[model samples]
Target: MKLSKEMRGFQDRIGHQFARPELLVRALTHASISSPTRSDNQRLEFLGDRVLGLVMATALLEDDKSASEGQLAPRFNAMVRKEACADVAREIDLGEVLKLGRSEMMSGGRRKLALLGDAMEAVIAAVYKDAGFEAAQAMILRLWASRINAVEDDARDAKTSLQELVQAKRQKPPAYELVSRTGPDHQPVFTIVVRLDDGAEAQATAGSKRQAEQAAATALLSKLEQKQ
Candidate 1:
């Protein structure tokens, strides 16, 4: 239950401390760690997922004075997507604070996108439970303010923006082909490839085809940006 000095400083820097340090401990504990006394972050990840959605939804409502549900839904999804959360977690070095078993540690679980992303959500849930929604909202704001601001611009929809970019060059509309699927039918992981007319392609995976298509589109746009 004891945190290193660096971890303590990290909490301080974020302007919140856990009332029950075990909550924070559990938030950062991956399931790969097997010990009678150790708990995994899965449950915390579940709670945190809801907390993160609610926080982001409330923020979007408050910040977008004229946005309808239709306008805000994509923005919300983009903001709370796993990759986005993982990016924020990495920025704060949350991986360094995680407690992993030797197996997980050796296998690079600390850098695993899914685990890091889930831990970020679990941390958000812990903050909300320990302190309150305001604290959690503040934390999200600190991490997402820039992205939120960019969302206000018309170019926020990466998929649609990418489509336009392709069209402007008189190219065919991009096609998304299913590359692979894994996991149970009820919760399938879809891998999709976005093929452009210029013979360029990008692939991404998500929990659903729609999400996978969006991810693939985003990746294609990123590649286009890099080329320019």
Candidate 2:
């Protein structure tokens, strides 16, 4: 089956020339569009997740021969997590090519992090099925080169670092509370407050609760560091 010009352009952007264009189409088809004749990307997402894990595991070990599993584990999580996959999807403009049903489209499904991440994984599985592991690995490594290189940076995300610090000090885990929510349902701003038992606290706002929590943790950590 021939692909539309837009999808072809997307293929070029991702640097994968699909031998089975149908797989690409299927990968872009979301559950919201499921029907008797149409299939969603759920199964493909499952397979692609394993494919991604294998590729990342091998890549991590190759990059550092002496690193322990403890060291590599968090890095692997940072790379393969849903948010990371969603970031890659955004980079490729995968959302634009997604085939969402009317309700999904109405609710901004294209920009949804979960949807984008799942679709990205499905696309990876499609590449693997259409070609082979070699082709899929090549695409993954190429697309994820920057993230792989910056694994250390990801390892130090504010929430994790803050947790470690508090644990070492024999304090209760930092508590995150939703302070407020603003804006429309489609584009909401979340205000999260991160507070320590020692009376230190910080508040931050972002498009998502997770992001807001991270920001709040970062702010409080910085303030604590300044005192020391």
Candidate 3:
């Protein structure tokens, strides 16, 4: 499985080349792009999820020796969250390099958050399968180093920050409502609305309900701050 000139350049930028280039292609191929009979990244996503968890856990443990599990769990979750994965995909411009079927391409599948996020995970799994754990860990760390700092500094805890802002204003706490949930069982996407007493509302989406709610709260807080 020979890589195209474009893919070779991509591998060079990411600092890793797949031993089995087909695995890299498969990892980039979403189910919407390829039939199950051919190949897709679902299995790779499953494996990547665990690999990602281990990599992030190890990094967190090494960085925060005094942190408790309770404090660490949210930070870990924030790091591996789909939104974070999609952020990395955008940084790498993965959407431009994705190979999609005609229909999926027409439907804007490349820009879809779920597709981008899953493709990122699949790529992680491919790197692990091609090189090994250390290679994958290095790739993930390179992409996620800044995000880990944000998590450690509490910059990623939008919900908590929003609550603090609301309290400072002497207003009642904002409330979150589930506006909608879409996507499959294994990878559900949620849209949530956060409402403040002043009739302001903001909406956001995340891979899970709680994450969506936090995003919504963050958005609401931003709006409030802008008004002030």
Candidate 4:
């Protein structure tokens, strides 16, 4: 089967020319749109997840030969998390080509984080199947090079790290307060403030309370680091 012009453009963006074009089609297909004859990307997502994990693990070990498993594990997670995959998918506009059913399209499936991340993994699996491990590894390394380089900072969980820092200083744990929630219920924006017992505090806003809390914690951590 011939690739559509849009898919060809997507190929250029991803720096991969799929020899088996049907693989790309399957990769782009969502379960919501799948029929008895047509397959979805779920299986491909599973394979892609494993392929991504192995590549990330190898890269982390190579990047930090002396690092312990404890240290490397977080960095690997930082690179392979659903949020990270979604971010990369957005970078390449992967949502633009997602094959969704009418219901999914009406509900804005293309912009959904989970769908985008899963599709990204499916695409990775398609590439791995079309070519081989080497091709998939090269594509992943190219796409994720910057993230890998920045993983040291990204691997640090702001909330957990902040808690550790305050506890080390003999302070009470940080508290996250919901300042306000705006936007529609379907897409609410949360404003959160993290306050320490000693009065150090930071505020942040995000689409989810957890993200807002993490942002607040990260901001407070920055301030604490500055003072140290």
Candidate 5:
């Protein structure tokens, strides 16, 4: 069960040494690169998703003893969401260690948010299987500490909250437009504009369409707040 030099280096970065080196290798393997003897991480990803949920639920309760269920729900979602996992994966450069097919690698799979997120979860499950729940919990908590700390600042997605506010004012739902697109096909930047019928609008550019829309909504929401 000895780890290769490169895998051991990856273990060092993640702060978890695998007892079963094969588990680490399997966890790093992607479905796109599957072989007869090679197993992908989809199963591990499923288990890790549950493990992450349980850990986040426990942490949220412990952090805010007085918060009601309604108050804690969104915080829990934000922490356990794929985006959060992907953020942690990027921190550890998990993508660099992944074993992807030639097509995936050529298409920039290493930089894909979903691929990184799933790999991160798989790694969590690998740690959990190799050691135990407590070890997995410790690793998750350490990697997610900063995000967990900032959970209370804003729980709602800006676009949803802004939609509610506009409806309350008798305005139609905001219109979102694709203003412009820049960057490469593999890693394109999108410019999104969120505009109201009355002409108040804000534009934002981001790596993804959803992110750009959210940023645009957040910017427009802030602009509205300043006027009031």
Candidate 6:
């Protein structure tokens, strides 16, 4: 199949030329727009996830030969997590090429973290299928070079750091509570509260629960750190 002008442009952005343009098309097609004749990217997403994991694992081991599994695990997670994929997708404007159904389009599917993350994985799979593992790995490493270089800082997110700080102080792990959720199903906002066993607490609101929890944890951790 021939590639569309827009998709070809996207190819330039990601720096990959698809031998099988159909793979790219399939990767961009969301389930909401799928039909008996047209497949979605779910299968590609599954395969891409494994490919990404392997590449990240190897990269981490190569970068930190002396690091133990305990140290590498979180860095791996930070690099391959859904949010990280979505961030990369946003960087390349992956959402612009997404093939969404009317309902999905109306609901801002292009900007949804889950959708963008899934599509990004599918795109990786497409590149793999179009060429080979080496091609996919090269693309991934090129796009994620900065993130991999800074994996240490990326691994210790606010929430994890907060948990470790409390643990070191002999306090129970911090707890997160969902205070409220509002807005439409597709665009709901979550308010989360993170509390330390010592009664220190902080609340934050965001589009996703994880984000809200992280914000809450950062706030509480900041307060705790100030006292030290």
List the lowest-lDDT window of 10 residues for candidate 6: 64-73
Report the C-alpha lDDT of model 1 over 1-228, residue by residue, as the tens digit. Answer: 687797787687666887778788888888887467888889889988898899888888887654545457779888888988888888888999888889888999879898889999999988988998888889888887887887645225667878899889999999989999999989899999999988999998878786677778877877889999
lDDT (C-alpha, whole model) for all candidates: 0.82, 0.92, 0.83, 0.91, 0.88, 0.91
How does residue 60 of candidate 2 score in lDDT?
94
Q: Which residue pairs clash in candidate 1?
A: none
Clashing pairs in 6: none
lDDT of 2: 0.92
Better of 3 and 4 by TM-score: 4
Model 2: worst 10 consecutive residues (lDDT sum): 64-73
Which digits, one per residue and each the tens of the lDDT, describe model 6 over residues 1-228? 888899999999999998889999999999999999999999999999999999999999999774556457778999999999999999999999999999999999999999999999999999999999999999999999999999978887677889889899899999899999999999999999998899999998878887687678777866887888
| lDDT: worst 10-residue window of model 1 | 150-159
Candidate 6 at residue 18, lDDT?
86
- The C-alpha RMSD in Å for every predicted model, in order, reads 14.0, 13.5, 13.9, 13.2, 13.1, 14.0
lDDT of 2 by residue, 42-70 (tens): 99999999999999999999987745554
Provide the TM-score for each candidate, comma-separated.
0.67, 0.72, 0.68, 0.72, 0.71, 0.72
The local lDDT score (0 to 100) that residue 62 gets in candidate 1 is 86
Candidate 4: tens digits of C-alpha lDDT, residues 1-228: 999899999999889999899999999999999999999999999999999999999999998774555456668899999999999999999999999999999999999999999999999999999999999999999999999998877886678889999899999999999999999999999999999999999998888887688778878877988998
Candidate 2 lDDT for residue 194: 93
